[model samples]
Target: MEKPPSYGDSNELEQPGDDRALPPATLYVAGRFVHSDDPQAPPLYELSHSVGFLSDNDRVVRLERLDYTVRQYQGTPQVSTRARHVYDLTHPTLATSPTFAYHAEATSRRSLCSFGMESFRARTLSSAKGYRVHRAARGPDHRLVGREELFTAVPARDEAVVFEWYDARGGLLARETDNGELLSLLVSAEMGPRERDALVAAWILRVWWEMARDKGLGRWDDGAECP
Candidate 1:
């Protein structure tokens, strides 16, 4: 397997590849779920249960059963679809088993009509490493994008855990940290809008998977709320 990105003095941040300035942007939790009012931060994305919202309170994504739909909040209505994902759970079959065998198509629109379809999958390797991620996007042919992994970081009494996604070449794409009280995300400034959307979609899928395992929810019919 390919190795993950290298971290440096800035905690788990990727070491700079060039001298170009990279602006500091941190989205701090400020609302019911994950929200940010900081001007420098990216759009305020909020999530709770099966629905999600942008800073403008526009419904951006909704999840149900095995599928989820994502709408572009700032695009033309004629083709505002941002992403569409359908999750499949396998392995041990029963929700009671903590085994992980799941996959989903987490695709993001490249334009108003075209999409960079990504195949996302997750499986458990051991108790120490909770889950492993593999995602690839297809243009004319399928190509490897990257994966998400956990790294050691400064721990806080209230902080839950930290997860980071890196591109195939070891560039940091995004990092998510959740505390019992709030959530935060540190995204790479170089990331494009479409790619960023797809990254967020991946997180949403992972979050739902985690919730299912935690609550022993065998089916979406259980309607488990976000915690």
Candidate 2:
């Protein structure tokens, strides 16, 4: 599999700084279902692209138009809007903090979930929990049933991100690692087809958002404007 781009170096892309703020750029991250060349593997959907929001000065402050591809029971392909999340950089978590609020909305009935994060840390945690699954509904009052915890975000000695997904009973479901750019996920047989698809979607969204957040923070730390 091809590795995604890294966000560490500002020289690769236009650097965003207070003195020389760049125009907003729309970068896209794609997620696709993977399988073997052999016919034995289940059919997968095509890659889906979603946009992450950047400020006028090119700082990521929100994520929008998140879409996921899913297959119907009749084997038809469908694209569904997952959720939109807005983040408050100054006080991303605390309600009383200046410009501190996190909000999310579901874009379609096909999306079985919606979420809100108190902060960036909480956003990471929620991503780790597979976006907090909920009953598919048209409104925001849906009840959350369960979630998937893939791994801890803490960096290892090698600076690699280790991941492990487990079921509610504590059975291991999947594992993978992210070393800078490349990220791989190994799904267990115990997971159902629906669950495997959901996990893959959540994993992709989380990774992309984190990268955008890192890039934005890098710019902000270098003295870019904030909300």
Candidate 3:
């Protein structure tokens, strides 16, 4: 595996080699679900479920599904699909489990505010690290929410990655090392998720990338994107 790019350099981003890219996968769909043709129409929660597929080369690799629902505020139903639970096609044992899940609930009586506030929790199932969960309470905007320790197999005597998430921020920050050598200074905060589905996907991909490296299935290359 090539050394991960220096995080200090703003131009360097972690990317995969062209020859060893993520199995040549293709996404099938990319859009939101809605109930009506009107621009202001809300999604029919009962019939609206986001679905997509990831295929490698020509073979299907996995299926993605997201169940959505409208959130209520002060007796008014919000058109925004604020609650989402994501699931990936997997073995029978894991079929019932969600690859990633996120849900936001109202915290205050003020519902029409431009920047409404709510508490959220996200969790993911990792093949390498079992299950990981993160929680954040209602707080000031841009405040530090929490930190996560990510274990990696980089042939280090004792090395691991630290990930930090912030409220109101759209990305995650990561610090990594290899064999006691500083492999990454600080991963791009800009790489974090911009939406609910993206937030879950980013975390899952981060874990899978390390797991692939540890298992010798792939090497961590600075030229490759995370998972």
Weakest lDDT window of 10 consecutive positions for candidate 1: 108-117
User: What order do candidates take by TM-score, descending?
Assistant: 1, 2, 3
Candidate 3: residue 144 lDDT (0-100): 22
Per-residue lDDT of candidate 3, residues 35-107 (tens digit):
2223343332211222211111111112122334577899998644333222221112224332222212212
RMSD of each: 13.5, 17.2, 21.1
Residue clash pairs of candidate 3: 15-222, 15-223, 15-224, 15-225, 16-223, 16-224, 16-225, 171-192
lDDT of 2: 0.33
The alpha-carbon deviation from the true structure for residue 83 of candidate 1, after best TM-score superposition, in angstroms, is 11
Query: Which candidate, 1 or 2, would have the higher lDDT against the true structure?
Result: 1
Best candidate (score: lDDT): 1
The residue-by-residue lDDT of candidate 2 on 1-31, one tens digit each, is: 4222222221332212212322222111222
User: What is the lDDT, from 0 to 100, of the residue 120 in candidate 2?
Assistant: 23
What is the Cα-based lDDT of residue 63 in candidate 3?
A: 17
Question: What are the clashing pairs of model 2?
Answer: 93-118, 150-164
TM-score of each: 0.42, 0.38, 0.20
lDDT (C-alpha) at residue 195 in model 3: 28
lDDT of 1 by residue, 1-227 (tens): 43332212114222232223434345444422333335543333433343211221222233211112345666843322222221211222334332223333332222111112222332245243223445432323242343443211122223444766665455666566765434455765565333444454455545444544455322322222223
TM-score of 2: 0.38
- Candidate whose TM-score is highest: 1
Score residue 103 of candidate 1 by CA lDDT: 33
Clash count for candidate 2 is: 2
